[model samples]
Target: MERRSHIYGVMGEFATPEQLTHAVEKVREAGYRRLDAYAPFPVEGLSQALGLKRNLVPLITLLGGLAGGVGGFGFQYWVAAITYPMNIGGRPLNSWPAFIPVTFELTILGASLAAVFGMLALNKLPQPHHPVFNVHRFSHASADRFFLCIEARDPKFHLADTARLLQSLHAHHVSEVSDD
Candidate 1:
């Protein structure tokens, strides 16, 4: 584990979602993309303010559903026509109509399962620890406060300048967040 850092970035605490939202917009306009905002509840237009446009979960789910549907249909066709041929009602060997229900059901199931797992994988969930937790009052982010964290990795980041910028946005308090 290599460690050499006194601070992670600057975190600005805000009392309202509006403040947080305005701060995020300003930060984005300031050409800082490495930032995260926290709020007690989902705020309107936050995602837009952050310019988060791409979402891959739905695409994953759709591909999963397609695979399931095709697999279900193929499996049934192979089973009834090749693996175990049984002519109960003299139906055609490649019985596509009979496979429809199972195909639909498996498609639904696969889509739902993919949505759950794909979202977790894409977002890199289950992160039990992070630098933001070092902030003493950050816990209130889930209670009644909003927070904006501008990471040091951003090209526009400068400790003092970022702090001053955040303050200029009317932050209630700006804290020097650490990674240790």
Candidate 2:
């Protein structure tokens, strides 16, 4: 068996979302950037309280769509105009209007794919485990409880002071989380 010695962070269990939100706000105000919140359901305004910035998934999706559109049109144009050209019935080989459907379909496909993959990548999904799971109380996070955690890696994170702050914020329980 491997001996675990590293501390991941300190976690506070709250009875309500409001308390959890307040704790996050206060922790942020105290200059702790490495913090996260969890609740059984979505908590309104929690993202703002955490001071999270806008994500880049939209831009990524747009770029993917544009690339797909250009690629689709270029490929069609190359095939019709250069690769296997046939001027049938006095009609032009490079028909821009004819490629609209395939281009549009490819654009939608690219955007949808980019949105899915980009969101997963940005959120770092597929993780088998996280250090917070070490706290047995965290299981309630998927139920009725709310939680706030301040990582030890934060510059302003002092274990004693952070625990005291959480206690002052009306946490039901405060515990240390070990990164085993």
Candidate 3:
């Protein structure tokens, strides 16, 4: 196994959603721009508190749809009229009407594919390992607990200072999370 230095980060475990929300707000106001929050369920205003902007899901879908439309139409046009022209019923090889169905199908197919794949890529899915998981208490986060983990890699992070900040935010416990 390849061994690497452990990267430690401050983590604030909150017992309640309200504490998590309030902690998030204070963390932001404290100028720690790289903090994150976790809860059993979505917490209102948490995104705003973390200064997260709107996602690019819509933009990705739009571009994917455009590419699919153009690709489907272009491919069909080429195969039917240019590459291997097939003429039936004396209807021109470039029969756009015949291509409509495939083109439409491809447009929808591409948009759906992009929405799923793009979201996964953007969110960095398939991460089998994460430093937060190192915290034994973190499993509870998926249940009734709420958590906020600020990575040590954050520009403003200083081991002691970050932990102190988390404590000041009234977290139940501010533990150091290590990427092992």
- Candidate 1 Cα errors over 4 Å, as ranges: 1-6
lDDT of 2 by residue, 1-180 (tens): 112259888999999898888889988888889899999999999999999888899999999899888988999999999999998998989889999999999999888899999999998997879999999999999999999998888877777888998899899999999989
- In model 3, residue pairs whose N, Cα or C atoms come closer than 3 Å (at least 3 residues apart or on different chains), thus clashing, are none
Model 3 misplaced stretches (Cα beyond 4 Å) = 1-7
Candidate 1 residue 126 C-alpha distance from true site, Å: 1.5
**Candidate 3 residue 173 C-alpha distance from true site, Å:** 2.5
Q: lDDT per model, in order?
A: 0.90, 0.90, 0.85
Report the lDDT tens digits of candidate 1 across residue range 25-65.
Answer: 99999989989999889899999999989799999999989
TM-score of 1: 0.90
Evaluate model 2: give its lDDT: 0.90
The C-alpha RMSD in Å for every predicted model, in order, reads 2.9, 3.4, 3.9
Q: What's the CA RMSD of model 1 in angstroms?
A: 2.9
lDDT of 3 at 141: 93
Report the C-alpha displacement of residue 124, candidate 3, in angstroms: 1.8
